[model samples]
Target: MTRKLNLLLATGLTSLMLLSPAFAENMLRVSYPEDPKSADAQMTTDFYTLPLNIFDRLVESETTGPGQSALVPGLAERWDVSDDGLTYTFHLRKDVKFHNGAVLTADDVVYTFDRMLNPATKALNTDILTFIAGAEERLDGKADSVSGLKALDDQTVQITLTKPYAAFLALLAAPGASIYNRAFTEAAGDQFGLTPETTNGTGPFILRDYTLNDSEMLEANDDYWRGRPKLDRLLIRVVSDPDTLRMLFESDEIDVFDMDFAPTQTPYFYGADQWKDHIVSGPRVGIYYYNINQLKKPFDDPRVRKAFQMSIDRQTILDKNFYGKGKLEDGVMPRGLRCYAPAEPIAYDPVKAKELLTEAGYPDGVEINLQQVSSWSSRWSDMNQIIQAQVAEAGFKAKIITTDEAAYLAARKAGDSDAYTQVWSADFNDPDNFFYTFFSETGSKTRGYNNNDPEVFAAIEKARGMTDPAERCKLYQDLTARIVDTDAAWVPLFSLDHSFVVQPRVKHFIVPWNGWSDMSYYNVEVE
Candidate 1:
C-alpha cells in the first residue's frame, strides 16, 4: 500500500482509539503549554516540529557536546569539505523521494536555498545562511543568484562560503534548513499551514490531520529516506493551561508532559508513593531574563543599567518563584558551556540603586513600564512581579503590564515595548549563538538598542572571524565580560531547569541540549 493510504488508516485507528482506551495506550500523547503559531514547514518556530514529524535536516548532533555526528541520512548520504574550508560537496542518497513521490534532486536543494535567501520570503532565520557567498547580496536584491550555491549534477550539491564557520554544519541541522517539496508548497497556497492533512516533505513521518486549537496527528512514513519510524501513530495535544496539563499527566491521559510544575507544589505530587516512578529532570537550553531598551532614556546610561541590575534580588526571586529549581546567572552564557566566566553577581542594594538613579538625573524616582505575556510559564509571571516590587523599593517605580501571548510577541518583535521578559535558547551550542543574536549590533535589537560602539562591534567581528575553537573561546570570554560589566545591555536572571516525565516503556529517548528530543527513534512496548 502507498504511504498516503497507510496514513489514512492510521488516522482512522487514532480516532477509534480516542473512543476506546485500549488502542489509546499505543499512541504517544504529548502536551505543551504553547501551540505552534504555524506548521507550514518553512514559516514556524522549532516548537512546531515537536509534534509534526514531517521534516528532517542535513545532519544531527550527538548529546555528548557541541560535536555533531550523522544521524538519519536525509538527502545527503555523505559530505566532504574542501581543504581550504570554502566549499562543501554533498553526495545525494539514491532512491530517496518526497512524500508526493517526487525523486530527490540537487535542483530541489538549490531551490530551497534560493527561497530561504529571498527577502520576499521574510524567513526569520536568514542570518544563518548569510555566510554563503553572495547570500547577503541576494537577500538585499543586489544579486540575481547566490554565488555560493550550485547543483553539480542531479545527485550532487555544492556550497561555497566566503570564510570558514565552525558551526556551519550544525546550523544546517536546524529546522530552517529542512528541505521542502517546491511543487507541493506552491500548490497548497497560503492555506498550507492551516490545512490538516498535507504531504510535502521527505521526513520519517507525514502529517495525517491537524487542528489549530485541538490536536495534531502523524503517522510513520514507510518510504522515509532512512527508514520507517518504530511508532505507528503520534498525537500532539495542545493544552494552554498548566493546571489542566498537570491533571492530564497525573491521570495518565498524556504520555509526555513538557513543563514541570512549580517546585513548591512538586512535593504534593511526587511525594506520593504512587507518583515517585513518573518524575524526571533535565537541564534546559534557554536562559530566562529581562531586556532593557538600551536606546531608551534612563536605560541608555550604563550606570542606570547597572543600578537596575543591582536592585533586583535574583536569588530571592528564584527561591520564591522557582522554588530554587534553577541557577542564578552572573554572566550571559549558561554554566554548561566552557566560555562561561565566573563573576560575582550584583548584590541587592537599594541605597546604591538610589544613588545611581540620582546620578542618572532621576533623584525622586524613575517610573518604568514592564510588560510580559500572561500565558507564559507561571514562574516567569511570578518572577516579573517580584522584580517589580523589589525595584520600587530601590527608588524606581515599575508598573507591570500583562497581555495575551499573541499581543506580547507582536509588541516585542515590533520593538515598540519599553521593557519585557524574554528567553534565548542556543541555536548551535555556541556562546556566540546566544550573545550575538541579542547583544551584537548586527543582531536582532528588537528594542531598538543597537550596540553601535566601535570597540564592541570589533570584538564581535574578531570572534566571528576566528576559526580555531580555543581562540574563539578566549575572544567570546572577553566579549562576555565586557558586554555584561560595561554595556549592561540586559540583566542576567537565571538559567532554568526544564523537567519532564516519560513512560518507562519508551526507548531511545534522549533530551537534546536545546530541550527538543527527536522522537523518530522512540518506541513503546509492553514491559
Candidate 2:
C-alpha cells in the first residue's frame, strides 16, 4: 500500500496508541494550535513548521542565542560574491541526497529558483526573489525561466542580482527558498504537497505519513548529512483547544508545548515548582499590530486613522490579554532588528480620539468591522474584544469578526476587510525585510493596504540597494519615523516573548527568535 493510503486507513486509531513509549522507543510529541495551511514550502507562510524540517535551503539560520541568529551553510557548503556584490556563486555539498535517494546538485538549485519565480506557480512569496536579475521578466510571464540562475557545472550554481543587496543572503535563508528535487517535484504535478509521495526533500526529517487536518507523522532521515537525528519519530498532533493541549502536556502525552500555550494559563506553568526548570522563554523577532486598509471608509482620512490609533489602550491589552509578558512599543520595528529605535510613548486619550473623529466629519462616530482569527489564537480574540470595548468609549462601534487562519489570509490578500489584527514574523533579520515587505508600493497594494505615498516608497527602495551600512541604517530610521508618526500606517503593539515547556526527558531543544515557525528539532536529544 502507498504511504498516503496507509495513513488514511490508520486515521481512526487513537494517537495515544501510536505515540506511547511502548510503541515508539524514541519519539518526540508536540502540539500545534492549528493545522498548517500547506506543507509546500513556496505555497505557505503558516506551514513553516513542516518545511523547516522536511527541506534544506541553500543556506540555513543557526540560533546562536535568544533573539539571535546567523546564516550558515546548508545544502550549499560555501559561496563567493563578486566585487560589485551583484553576483553570488554557491558551491553545492557533494554528500547531500534527497529523500528519494536522488543526488543534490546545482541543477536542483537552478530548478528550485526557476519554479519559485515562475508566474504560473502562483508562489505566495515571489517578492523575496525579485532582486534577482531577470526575476521581473519571469514573474511578468515574459520568460520561461529566471535568466540570472545558471548551473556552471554539476556542483556549482551562480545567481546575479540587478543591484547590490546586503540582505540577499538573508532572503535565501527564508523558508520559501528551500531547495527542491526537480525530478520528484515535476512528476508529482499539482498534487505535490497534498500527497505523501510528492513531499520529499533533503533535510533532517522525512514526511513518513500525514493525515490531513489531524496529525503529521515524521521520521528521522538516517542519511542526513549533519548526523542522524537522536529521536526516531516525531509526531505532531493538531490540538487546537488550549484546555486539551494543557491536559496532554500534564499527562505526559506530549513532549513539548511551545506556541500553543494560552496566555491566561501561563501563570499556572510559571508558578508550578515542577515545571520551573522545564520552561524556556526569550524575546521574538516580530510585530503584532492591526492592518488598516486605507481604501476602507472612515480609515481613508488621516484624522480617523490617528484617532483609531489613540483609542486603543495598548498597555492595558498587553497586561490583561497577554498576561503582561511582552514589552509595548510605539514603532512598528520590533526589538531584535538592528535598526530598532525608541519612539515617543503612545497615549490612550479617549477625549482626544473623540475630538479627532468629530473633526473628521464623524461627530456621531463610525462603526467598523475588526476581524480576528480566533482559531489561530484564542488570546487574539480576547485582545480584539478589549480593543472593541476601548474603541467604543472613544465614539467608535467596533464589531469583532472572527475566522480561521486560511480564510483570514485569503481575505487579507484580496483586500476584502475594513480592518484586522495580525502578526508578522520576520522572514529574515534585516530591517529591509520588515519595511519592504509591509510598506513598499508593491507590498502595500498586494496586502490590500491601498496606501499611496511616493516619498516613503522611494526611501524604502533606496535603502535596500545602498552598500554602505551606516547610510542604509540612517535611511531605515527616517522611513520608520515617516511610517509611524507622519502617516500612521498601522497601529504598533507589543512584542511578546516566546515561551516553551518541554518534558524533562527532552533536552537541548533550541527556541528560535521567530518562535515555533522557525524552530528545528534536529539537534534535540531525547533520554
Candidate 3:
C-alpha cells in the first residue's frame, strides 16, 4: 500500500469511475481520461486510437523498432506515382469489405474524399487534404466533386495534386484520411459516427456498444482485410480521476495505463521496482511550447519576444514538473524525425532577459497573461506556476489563467490569448508537418499565431514542392533557425516521452514516436 496514498495530489484531481468488475482473458482493458467525442475520424479531433482500429487509410505508419516507423500500404495494396510526382494511382485490394458487408472499391475511395471535402460535411481537420488538386473547389461549393479524384475502375483510384507535395503520401497515412463506407455513412446521414451502428469502417475491429462518457466495447472483425485482431474484444473505459485510475490498474481492472494523466506521480510509478518490466517509454515526436501571439502588443517586438524566451528556465520546468521525463529541444522540429538537427541550447540568464526588456522600452517590468488548461495535463498547473516565478526574476509578471478545454481551444483559434501553452504531435514523420502546418500564413490563421512573415511563408511554400530531399531539409533548417532562434516566435520547451504502464497478461504492444496514430491494435495479443 506504499504506492497507494502517496500518489494523491491535492489540486488538479481528475474524475474517473470504473464500473466493470472483471474482464475476459481474451479482452484488452484500457482507460482514457476523456471519452472520445465521436467515432468518426474527420468529424472530430478526438483521440485516434478508437477510430484507427475501426477504419483503414490508404497507407499507414508501421512501427519497425522503438521510436521508429515507416510508411506501408493499408487499404491500397500497391500504388504508382507519375514521373512528375503530382499524380498517384492506388490499386485497392478486392478482398477488403466494410463492417456492413459492402465491398471496398474505387467508388468508396472517391466517395470518402468527396464527402470529406464537401462543404456540408464540415469536417474538422480537412486541412491535411488541402493540397489535393480540386479540394478548394469542392470545399467552396464551386464543384460537386473533387476534380483531382477519379475512379479509373472498380479497383483503381487516381488522385492528382495542384502542386507536387513531397509529403502527400504521408498525409494520406494520417488518421484524418481514414476511408469510410459510403453506404453506411449516407444511410446514417447526420447521425454518422455518433453511435455504434453508424461507426462502420473496414478496420480490424467493429464497435459493438458505446455508452457516452462511460465505456466502449469493440469486437474482432472476422471479415477484416487484415487478419482478425488477436484479442476478442477491446474495452476502453473512461476513467477521469487519477487516483481512481491508479486503483483500477492496481486492482487489475485495466491492462494498460498512461502516466500522463497523473504526471506528478509518474516518477514514483516509473521507479516502482514491482512495475519495472511493465513500463514502456519513448521520446515523443512533438514539441510542447508557449506560443506568443505576435500580433499582441509587447510580444510583437522581436526584442520583447526574445527577452520572454530567455526569461524562463526550461530545464527547471522539465526537471521539476516532469521529473526529468523529457528532453530539452531548441527548434520547432522534434527529435526522431527526418531533418532533425540539434541546435545550440538557449541558456537561462535572467539578468540578460531583464536587459533586453529594458532595451524594448519596459525599464521597470511587464505583466503577461499565461493561459493553460488543467484538463489536458495535471502538471500544467504546477508548470505554469514555476514559469510565473522564474519569469518574475526577469521583470515579467505572469497572470495564470486556467480554463476548460473547449474555451481554451476557441480562444487559441481566435488569437485571444496573449501567451498560451500548446503542444503539437506529428501526424506524419515529416518536417513539413511541423513547419509548414504551423508557420505558414494560411495554416497559422486556423491554429492561431498570427505570424504573417512573407519570407517564411515563401520558403515553406517552396520547400513543399522540392523533389530533392537534401535541398528541402536545408531550407527547413534555415526557416527553423529564423523563426525559433532569431525571431523567437515561440518559447520552445521540451518534448515529453510517451510513457505507458502495462499489465503482465498483455504480450506485445508498441506506440510510434508520435505516440497517438496507428496504434496497431490488431497486433495486440492478450493471454
Error of 3 at 395 (Å): 2.6
**Candidate numbers sorted by lDDT from highest down:** 2, 3, 1
Shift in Å, residue 335, candidate 3: 1.8
Per-prediction tally of clashes: 0, 0, 6
lDDT of 3: 0.81
| Alpha carbon lDDT of each predicted model | 0.69, 0.82, 0.81
TM-score top scorer = 3
Error of 2 at 305 (Å): 4.1
How well is each residue in 39-91 modelled by candidate 1, as lDDT tens digits?
A: 65457556645323676655654454321223334568789988777788988
Q: Looking at model 3, report the run of 10 residues with the lowest lDDT sum.
A: 5-14
lDDT of 2 by residue, 171-267 (tens): 8988889899899998987777775677889989888777777888778898998888897777888888878888888988888877434655688
> Candidate 1, overall lDDT?
0.69
TM-score for each candidate, following the candidate numbering: 0.82, 0.85, 0.89
Query: For model 2, what is the error of residue 232's alpha carbon versus the real structure, in angstroms, after optimal superposition?
Result: 2.7
* Ranking of predictions according to TM-score: 3, 2, 1
Q: Judge candidate 1 at residue 195 and give its lDDT.
A: 52
